[model samples]
Target: MSWELVSGLETHVELSTNTKIFCGCTTKFGGEPNTNCCPICIGLPGTLPKLNRQVVHYAIMAGLATHCTINNVSKMDRKNYVYPDLPKAYQISQYDKPLCEHGYIQLDNGRKIGITRIHIEEDAGKLVHEHGDTFVDYNRGGVPLIEIVSEPDIRSIAEAREYVEKLQMIMKHIGVSDCKMQEGSLRCDVNISVRPEGSNEFGTRTEIKNMNSFTNMEKAMAYEYDRQIDLLESGGKVTQETLRWNPDEGITTPMRGKEDAHDYRYFREPDLVTIYTTDEEIEAIRQELPELPDARIARYESDFGLPEADAQLLVKYRKIAEYFEAAGEGLANKKTVANFILGQIFRTLVTDEEKENGAVAIPPEYLHDLAKLLEDGKIKMNLAKTTLDKMLETGKPCTDFISEQDMGDIDEDTLRTICQSVVDNNPKAVADFKGGKDKAVKALIGQVMKQTRGKADGRKAEAMMVDMMNDME
Candidate 1:
C-alpha cells in the first residue's frame, strides 16, 4: 500500500546575543572545552539564574517577524529530566506559556504552514564521548534558544526544506540569531511518519535528532518516511522513539524511547520572577524589523523590474539584498544593477562551496563599485572579472585596483586595428567565412582577442571581424 508522508519540525535557534539565556556566561562557541561555564549556568550552590532581557526582546522580535500573536505575559518552567548533557537534571523551558503563538508562514506554492508556538528556553551542555571516558562541557548549558514548533502540515520533503529555509532567513534578517548549523547554534528535530493517503488518524511518528544542516534535515525526513512506510507494509508497527541520524550511513537509527511531557515534570521556577511585556514593547520590536526576504524579493521584482529568478537570487541573503539596493541608487537601469549583483558580484564571492558559507571577505561597497564601473563601461566584462578576482584577493575597489594594475578595457580604435590585423593573418578562415561557413567567423574573433591580449570587447571584435571579412567578399 502506498503511504503519504507527514512531517513536523522543532527548531532551536541560538540567539545571537553574546551571553547565555539565564546567566552571564560567554556564549561564544569553540573555547577551551569547558572554560566558558559559570555558577548559575552549571547549577552551583548559592547562585540563581537571571533572565537575559535581550533574549526576551529577540524572541518577541522573532514572533513579530513571523506574524505571530505576542503574549504579553510569559514565564519560565523547569523541565525535569535526567541526562548527561543537562547539568541541572532539568532544563528551564517554557511549556504552556510560550512567548508567542498562532503564527504562520506562507510557502511558495501558496500553502500556509501553521506555527503552533514559539518558546524561550535554555540550551543544554554538550557531551563529548571518548573511547574510555565521557566529558561534559557546560559552556552551552544556559545559552538562549527559541524553540519554534510547527504543526504537522508539511506533506513532502521539499515542503519541509522550504519551511526551514524561510524560517532561517526570517530569523537571520530579523537579527535575532546567527542560525549557523555547523556551530551547533541552530539545530532541528524532525518528527516524521507516514500513513495511507486520506487517512483521518495520523500514524506513529519517530523523532530524529542532530540534523544540524538543512540538507541533512531533508535527507532524514525522506529516509524516515520511507522506513515507516516499508515497516507498515510488512505488518510492522512504527515505534515512538528518539532516533539519531547517521549522516554517514544516510539512515536514522533508533536511539531510545521518546520522552513524554510528564517525563520532564515541568513546573514554574519560583527563583525567577514572571516575565511581562507591554504593547509598547511589541510595537517597538515590530517597527524595528527590517524588510524580510519574501517582502524584499517582491519589491525587487515589482518595484525594480527584476525577473523572479533574479529577485530570488539577490534577496536570498540580507547583505546581498542591501548591496543591490544601494547599487541601484541613482541608476537609470535597475536591471543592469540586478544583472551585476546576480552575475558578477555574487558569482565572485560564491565561487567555491566554502565561500558560499561566507568565507570570502569582500566588502559590499567594493561590489557596488564594481557594478558601477561595469555600468559605465569603463571596463569590459572580461576585465571586470579579472578586477573582481583581484578585489577579492586584496579587498580593494575595482576602479582603484584596475588603475593600479593598468588593466583597462582596450580602446575601440586599437581594437578595430587589431581586427584588421586578424583578418590579414587568417587567410583560410576568411575564405571559409566567404564560403558561408558560419563557424569560421569565430576563428577571426579569437585572433583579434589574442592579438589584443584578450583586452578587446569580444562582441565588438566579432562585429569588426564580420565587417572586414564582408568587405573582402
Candidate 2:
C-alpha cells in the first residue's frame, strides 16, 4: 500500500521588540552570556512580570496580516515545566485564550492551509553544553514570541517548506520579526505522520523539534515520513515521540516521548491582568500594515508587467522588494531593473560583511541610473555590469564611475572600425560566415566586444561585422 505524508508546523517567531516581553532586559542576540538578563526575566525572588505593550501590538499585526481573527480579550497562563533553560521553572504563555484564531495561508498552487491559532509566549533561555558541563544563559528567557500553529493540511514536503517561507516573508514585510533562522529568531517544529493513501484515519505522528533552516526542515520531514512508513509496512508500531534531526547524517533520532498539553499543567497566571483590545485599535494596525507578499507580487505582474517568477523573486525579501520599487519607480522597463539587481547586484553581495548587515553597498539611485542607461541603449549590458562592479566597490554613483572610466558605449564609427579589425584578423571566421556558417559571426562579435572592452553593443557590432564581411565576399 502507498502511504501519504501529512504535516503541520508550529513556528515560533521572535518579535523585534527592543526589550524582553515581561522585563526590561535587552532582547538583542549575542551579548555576554548572562549580562542582558534582569530580575523578572531571570525569575528572581520578589520580582513580578509586566507585559510589553509593543509585543501585543505586534501580535495583533501578525494576526491581521495572516487573516486571523484578533481576540478582543486574552490572558496569560503558566506552563509548568522543569528545564535548566527555563529559569522561571514555569513559562508564562497563552493556553486556551490565544490572541488570534481561524486563519489560513494560500500556497502557490492555490491550496489553502488552515491556521489553528497564534499565541504569544516568552522564549526560554539557552543551555550551552561544553566540556561535560552545561551553562544556562537567561538573556533570551523573556524574549517575546508568537507561535503560529498550522492545521494538518500540508500534504508534501514542498508544501511544508513553502508555507514556512511565505510566513517568513509576511512577518518580515510587516516589520514584526526579522525571521533570521541562523540567529534563532525563527524556528519550526514539524509534526508529521503517514497514513495509507485514501484513508481517513491518521497514523501515529512524531514531532521534529527546532528545524531552523528550510533545507533541513524539508530533509527532516522526508526522512521522518519514510521512517514511519517503513515501520508500518514492517508490521511494527510507530511510536509517538519527539525527534531531533541530525543534518550531517540526514536522519531523525528519537529524543523523548512526546508530551500532551496536560503534561505541562497549564493554569492562568494571577500576577498579570488580562489583555484587551478594541475594533478601533485593530483597524489602526491594519491600516499601518505594508502590502503583503502576495499582493505585491500581483501588483508587480499587473502594473509593472513583470513575469510571475521575477515578481515572486523580488517580493521574497522585503528589503529587496523595497529597493526594486524605489529604483524602478518610473522606469518603463522594470524587468531590466529586476534582472540587473537579481543578476549583477546580487552577485556582489556574497561577503560576510554584506550578509551580516543585510545591505547592498551600491545606492538605489545608482541602480536606477544603471537600469535607465541600459534601457536607453546608452550602455551595453556588459559595460553596465563592469560599471556596477566599480560602483559597488567604491560606493560611488554610476554616472561618475561611467564618466571617469570612459565606459560609454562605443560610437558607430569606432564600433565599425573595431568590427572591421576583428574581421580582418580572422580569415577563417570570415570564410565560414561567407560559407553560411551562421554561428561563426558570434566569434567575430566577441572579438569586437573584447577590443572595445565590452563597450560595444554586441548586436549592433554583430550586424556591422556581418555586413562588412558580406561586402568583402
Best by lDDT: 2
Error of 1 at 239 (Å): 2.7
**Candidate 2 residue 419 C-alpha distance from true site, Å:** 4.7
Query: Once superposed on the true structure, which residue ranges of model 2 sit more than 4 Å away at CA?
Result: 247-250, 257-262, 351-358, 403-428, 446-457
Model 1: per-residue Cα lDDT at residue 406: 41
CA lDDT of 205 in candidate 1?
Answer: 93
Cα shift from native, residue 439, model 1 (Å): 3.1
Model 2, 372-450: lDDT tens digits are 8878777788878888888888888887767533456577887777788899999999999899999999988778877
lDDT to native, each model: 0.82, 0.89
Candidate 2 vs. truth: CA RMSD?
Answer: 2.9
State model 2's lDDT.
0.89
Off by over 4 Å in 1: 248-250, 257-262, 344-370, 373-394, 400-421, 446-464, 471-473
Look at candidate 2 and tell me the lDDT of residue 155.
96
